[model samples]
Structures are given as structure tokens and as C-alpha cells.
Target: MTGPDKDEAVERAELLLALRKRGIRDRLVMRAFEQVPRERFVEPVFRNLAWNDQALPVDCGQTISQPTVLALMTTALELEGTHTVLEIGTGTGYYAAILGHIAGHVVTLERFRTLAEAAARRIGSLGLANVEVFLADGRLGYRARAPFDRIVLGAAVEEVPSALFDQLAPNGILVAPVGPPEGTQALMRYRRGPEGLEQRELGLVRFVPMLSGVAAVL
Candidate 1:
């Protein structure tokens, strides 16, 4: 391989090893992380650190989540090949691209129009046909395409929004970070069943706050 390709390969390998050491055991989740180039989702200034296990700022004051958190959330979702996913924060579109690799379809919503447009362009350039990016209020969820088999929120909130639960299909799984935006949050998973929504706390995490309404920026 060329020098850059070899370096990227090495970085990817090391990253996968680190994730495995951190107890990320799902093969599909690992493969998705391996396949998606994190550099493509980060700002040019932070491209060199793309493979590092840390969140990095993108446009619109948002951040692409750390690889470990993304993997954990993906694992919690328990996605199947046929599942359609609703992603609450598109950010740099990196996570949505990863979801595209594992799920049948991904509908991602971003409050910032600029971020949504950039994410759409990036996902399109990658030819990730299964993923769609939209500029909208994520808290409201996408009712037009209600009944998603899987839903993931990249931002943190005090609690899971009821609107999202209404959009989840029976037996669907919704994974999100729940807590105050300034402090540590719990990575939670909610499964819709015959009885109701079943909740599980995966781990503590930190993420940006889940905001309401669309961004005012043109």
C-alpha cells in the first residue's frame, strides 16, 4: 500500500484493537467503524486525529461523537440488516454513514441547515444510498416516516422524548444519552414491546444537549 494508505490501515487496526480492549465485542459494529473513514467526517484541522477515541467539533458548534460511544450505541441498538433507523443528530454524518453500512435505511435529522447540507453532500460523495439527511427539529422526530425499527440520538437530553417513542415500531430499539448536557450522561436503551417501553442504562457518556426547533442560521 501507499504510505498514507498504510498509515490509515495501521491507525484503523490500532483503533479496532483499542475498542476491543474496551469491551466492544460486536463484529458488525466493529466492521462498520473499520469501514467508515473518520477523517472524512472531521474538520480539516482535526483530520489527523480522526481515528483517536475522542469527540471532535464539526460545523454548527456540534461534535462528532467518539468512536467508542458510537460503537456502544450501535451495539445497544441491536440492528438487523432490514431495520430502518432514525438518527436524531446528523452532525458530520459520520455516524449515519456507519448506520448505513449496518441498517437497511437511515433517516438523520439535524437542526442546523448548514450542517445538514454538508452532511448530505458528504454522505452522497461516499455513495451511501441508504442514508438521508434532513434539516429539522430532532425532538419532534420524523412522523412522515414513523415506525422506525431503530432510533439513535447523538445528543444528550434529560429524558427520552415521548415523540420518539411514538415513532418507534413495536419491538424497536432506541438508544440515546440521557442526562444534563454539562455533566456525565447515561447511555440508555429503550425497547418497545407489547407491554410498553422497557429501559436499560448502558453506561455513562457525555454529549451535546438535544435542542428544540431548527437553527436560525441561513
Candidate 2:
């Protein structure tokens, strides 16, 4: 297909520019976000609005995270190539793809079997072999791949899951949106230091509630 029209291109440019405006200055993070086509991750009906700085609905009541929020969460983690990352809530597998681009290996968990399968296919088709998608309750983390160098939750949880904290390696980082069920969510960054786990509230943000157990329908 032809490239987006001038107005559409301007909108797309503004999206990334807005992210930079919000202090998502990490070059690697920005490049990865630009490289991965957000348009491909959403349904065809929403493709025209893909570049907008807004969440669009996908299958199974899940929404593709807004790009600014995604960049914020990713930049907070500060991933490196050697880090083995575990991602919770593999919605559309877009965030996992970004993590896979920066980290050594990314093990992403999805509670819905259908989402997991779709993510697996998307990642494979993209030729991202470093990513492994799992259909499991992400709140438990992945014991088989314990000792993650970094853990990122795509959905918001009321509290950090103890199991996830245990799975983090010494000096590892965990970034998530934590707070009440409503709109008041804080983007928190937890570091498992030699002394103990330390938490810092980065900024206010919002995300879909992180749920336990698989989707009953799917």
C-alpha cells in the first residue's frame, strides 16, 4: 500500500514527537518504538487510528497500550542486551516485541490462550526468535524462567505480586502501574538491590487492571 497521506504522516510524526516531549529520550527505546509498526498490532478497523496517542480496542476486551505509556514503562526499565526479561500481559505482543528488540530473551505471559496463540504467531512471523509466549497466570510469574534480570507488567495491579518479586534477580528492576482500580495509578519502579527490594513512584499513569487466572471464555 502507499504511504500515509501528508496529514496522516504529520499525525504519526506528532505521536513520536509527543513521546519525546514527555521525556522518553532514550534513543534505543525511541528507535524500537518507531521500528515496530503499531498499525500492524491492532485490528484492521483501527489501523487508521494506529498512530494516535490513544488506546484502541483489540480482541478479548484488551486494548493496545498508548505509545507514550509504553515508552514510559520501557524507558523506566532501562533494559540491556544481557537482561532476561519477563513480561506480564502480552496484549497484541507489541510490548514484548519492543523488549525482545532490546533484551537477550523475553518470556511474555498471557492469561488468555487465544491471545497467547496470536502473539506467538505474530512474533514468529516477525522473525523474533528471542521471544517466548506463555499461556499462564502471569501473577505467578514464570518459575521455569526464574531469576529474570527485568520484569515488566503490561497491566496495572493493586500490589506487586510477591511471586514476581521473588523471581527478580539481585539488582534487577520491575516496572508496573500500581494503585486503585479507578483512574489513579502510579507508574512504579522497583529495584531488587543487594540490601532488599526498593520501590520508587515514577509518575502517575493508568492501565488495564492486571487480572489473575485465564480468561474463562477463551
* TM-score on alpha carbons, each prediction: 0.95, 0.93
Candidate 2 local lDDT, 142-208, one digit each (tens): 9999999999998889999999999999999999899986796999999988789899998888788
**Per-residue lDDT of model 1, residues 1-218, tens digit only:** 21344588788888898789889999889999999988899999888788888889888778998898888889889988999999999999999999999999999999998899989999999899999999999999999998999999999999889999999999999999999889899999999989998999998999999999999585
* Pairs of colliding residues, candidate 2: none
RMSD (CA, Å), each prediction: 2.4, 2.4
Model 2 weakest 10-residue run by lDDT: 1-10
TM-score of 1: 0.95
- Residue 135 shift from truth in candidate 1, angstroms: 0.7
Give Cα-based local distance difference scores for all models: 0.91, 0.88
